[model samples]
Target chain A: MTGSRRQRVAKAVFLHAAALVVVFLMAFPLYGLLLTSLQPESVIRSRELSIIPQTLYFEHFRAVLAEGHIVPLRRALVNSTTVSALTAVLCLLVGLPAAYALSRLRVPGRNVILGALVSVYFLPTTIFLIPMFVLLVRWGIDDTVFSLVLAYTGFILPFVIWILKTFIDRLPLQIEEAARIDGCSHWQVMIRIVLPMARPGVLAAFVFAFILSWVEFLTPLIFTSSLRMTTVALGMFRSTIDIQVGQQAAAAVLTLLPVALLMLVCQRLITQVLMSGADK
Target chain B: MQAVPDSPAIGGQDEWTRAPGTLRRRETAFSLSLVAPALILVAGIYLYPAVYTLILSFARFDMAALEIGRWVGLGNYKALFANAAFVDAIWRTIYFGLLIAVGATVSGFLIALLLNEEFYGRTLLRVVVVLPWAVPPVVAGVLWGQMFHADVGFVNALLFRIGLIENYRIWFGDGRTALHIIALAEVWKAIPFMVLFMLAGLQSLPPQLHEAAAVDGATAWQRFRHIVFPLMLPIIIPLMLIQFVWAMKAFDTIFVLTRGGPAGQTTTLNYFVYVEGFQSFDMGRASAAAYSLLVVTLGVVLMVTVLRRYAALRKATA
Candidate 1:
């Protein structure tokens, strides 16, 4: 018994050591990015690399925020936020009803429609970019934030519908029936009964759509030319080409912040949703 | 038909019944009202653009020719097939998809298995694992690019310090290494997402199965093979297929890292389409290429769905 216990303790120690290695490997690049962003440009260009900053230079952050061609950065952030928020709202506006129909009402061709939407979720958005660009140019909205939002909605709606539909399907149908018997109309049942119950799912869908739009790069990179319409991702690309490492890192950190916060805030729900989505 | 006294039909409600006409009408209206907005938005934004791209593929709509261009039928597609660069890109994309999907899925599953253990600071470790995914793909690409820099990159710095290399090597200056490096970047950036999903799958699994296996004196490898692997397959297969499709369309990472550089060695099909459309302004050819990619992606999706259905049927029968 003692021998077996010792063996178990040895295995535990080995497992813990392995876990520590994994954590270090995963976090090292980010730590390096943070440290590099804090170092002055002259120190960064020096022959010898310093693992730790000798003196903290917060000026890099100020320079990134104040000095460089920040107009594009500012515009990109605004555009990204606007496009992402609009996409989320639009997705909810359209998807909630479709999900309700799928969940509650027996519509003709419902199964086929659901299957088609799910398939479209797997389809590559890049495939549609070329023709979408042409159509946008023809309609004179190619480079506009409006086009970006539209594209984001189209790209994201299928996933949103799928997620919401699953959640709605799991809801107790008897409650809606009770509401109806209480003399509530179908719309009333949806607004008063179903919507409140599916709040978590809706939040999940909104966060998903928002992140997708915010991080999207291809559509904007191909369609837009004006600096005013660039996204944070595109802004990072421009900064990299301009060799502004500090600004690039800062932008990278900023872009990551909101999504990280959202994930932490809704960790359990997001985890469940993401797992279901991946599990098919 | 006799009215059934407030008894709503449970299963087979006829649409044209006179007794339930009011109920039927209300249901129809509700259904239409619920679905109309989504249908319109999806059809207008998604379906129309896809169809329009198909049509553009068959036409010779160059900018110089403008609206005066003639329909060339399958000429654009034919030209794409004949173009060596395009063909090469398709092969590269397939290779890239296979490499990164397999790499990310396997490594991610391993990491998930590790993280699933009851260890101290597990939450902090989870955060660390997911950090790469939180960083925007563009930023991740730039970070990797910086790391691979020959003169000042941390990668080279570490290697030189460890005496593994006599001098810093130009990692991105060569075609062969450039594609692999970009693939590595994609794998690193995307593995965290795969791990998150796989970890969820692992956690959802019943621990009693492992306990029972252990009681039966099964070795660790045997337990993993006989119990864990089979249980996880349901989630693993679908995630693998989706990851494959996503990798095929990977662009931002490659774009920021190499810009499909070192003489177009790292250019996947998606990057090829972007270059053709925006850089060369060859809308006709780009649309054709994009259509082909769309067809392939759709084909893969269909295959995955059919596979999932088949698995479900088998499980039901068993």
Candidate 2:
């Protein structure tokens, strides 16, 4: 009996140790990024590396955050925010009604529409890359954030609509029926009855759309030029090519701030969307 | 048909109270209208472009004139197949996919199983594990790139300090190591999703089965091999398939890390398309390559669907 008890204790200790190592390995890169960004250039450029910062450095942050610098970080952040916020808003504005139609009303060929959307969601972004670039450029919107908005809206709309549909599917039918009986139109039923009930899903879909757009690299990189139009992701990449490791790290940390905050607030909902097989 | 109910909120009360078929038709119109914008966006942005790309694949593109010159009829595809570099990219992409599918899934399973065991800080660990998922794919490239930098890289400094290497070597300057490093970046990002799925699968498992197994005096490995693994297979297969598809399409990390380089060694099919389309302006060949990638993705999707059906059939027969 004592031997079995001791073995169980040993197992627990081993498990904890293993968990610690996994977490440390998984998190060390991010920690290193932050540490490298904070350390002075001397420490950063040194052949020897230390996990701990000897002296704090603000120049990289200041330089990255400065106005009118190449791949200007402030403008990039603003552009990213504008594009991401627009993507989220546009997705909700367009996605909510479609989700409602698909979820509640008997839209014709609902399954087909849903399947096509899912397939498109699963399809490679490269399939649409060339034509989108040509079309956007031809339309004289290629270098604009609005162009990014249009592209991201189309890209993120499928996921948003799918998630919102799932959310609306869970909503009770009785409330909607009562609203319709009380002389509410279909739009009213959607806006007044189902919308409030599916608020969590709405928030989740919005945040998901926002984060998806925010972290995007391919579209912005392809669609936009000029430092003002640079996205945080693109800026980080270009900065690396410029060999500004400290600034690149600073840019990365700054770029990740909003996403980290969003995840903190809506971790469970985002996890649901991810595990729901959206293929992050 | 269900009765057309009152809908005073709509502007036309007579329209709502009109002939029953009219009201129903109007309702259907409303539903269709509600669904129209989304479908239009998808069709206009995705479907139209995708079809255009497919059509362009078989045609000769005149870059100067910026239009289709002639229908070459698989000329582009033939060119792609004939090119040794393109062939290498296809095989290299497959290799990268295999690495990620195996590496992420296995490590994900182990970490998830460890987390499944009761321990302090499990919640914290799960959160920390998911941090990578929040990092943008490009930023993940940045993190890993910085970590393995030749001069100040933590990997190099630590390896040297530990006597693993006499000197700090450029890891990305070589083809094989570059591809492996990018794969590592992707695997690191993908593990969170895999673990998330595995944990959900693990938690949903019935506790009594494990208890019964323990009562039978089965070793941990024996229980895992006999029961847990088999039960987890359904989840694992689809998860790996998804990972494989993501791996095949991996571009951002590769773009940041090597730009498909150290002499085009690490270029995947996706990166090949980017280079052909944008850099080389070989629109025709790029379109063909893109279609090939689509076919590969669709093949995986079909495989997953068929495998799932087969699994279901086997279970029923058993």
**Range of the 10 consecutive residues with the lowest summed lDDT in candidate 2 chain B:** B1-10
List per-prediction Cα lDDT, in the order shown: 0.79, 0.85
Report the number of the highest-DockQ candidate: 2
**TM-scores for candidates 1 onward, in order:** 0.90, 0.94
DockQ scores of the candidates: 0.47, 0.53
Give the TM-score comparing model 2 with the true structure, all chains together.
Answer: 0.94
For B1-318, candidate 1 gives per-residue lDDT tens digits of 111123242323243344676766667676877898888888877788678777888887767534416788999999999999889988888788878888889989989998888777777888888878777777678778777877668889888888999988999999889899888888888888889888888988999999999999999999999999989987788778878888888888898888898899898888888888888987788889887777766676677789789988998999
Candidate 1 residues lying further than 4 Å off, grouped into runs, are A67-71, A239-241, A276-280, B1-18, B64-68, B295-318
| Candidate 2 deviant stretches above 4 angstroms | A238-241, A272-280, B1-23, B300-318
Worst 10 residues of 1 chain B by lDDT: B1-10
lDDT of 2 at B35: 97
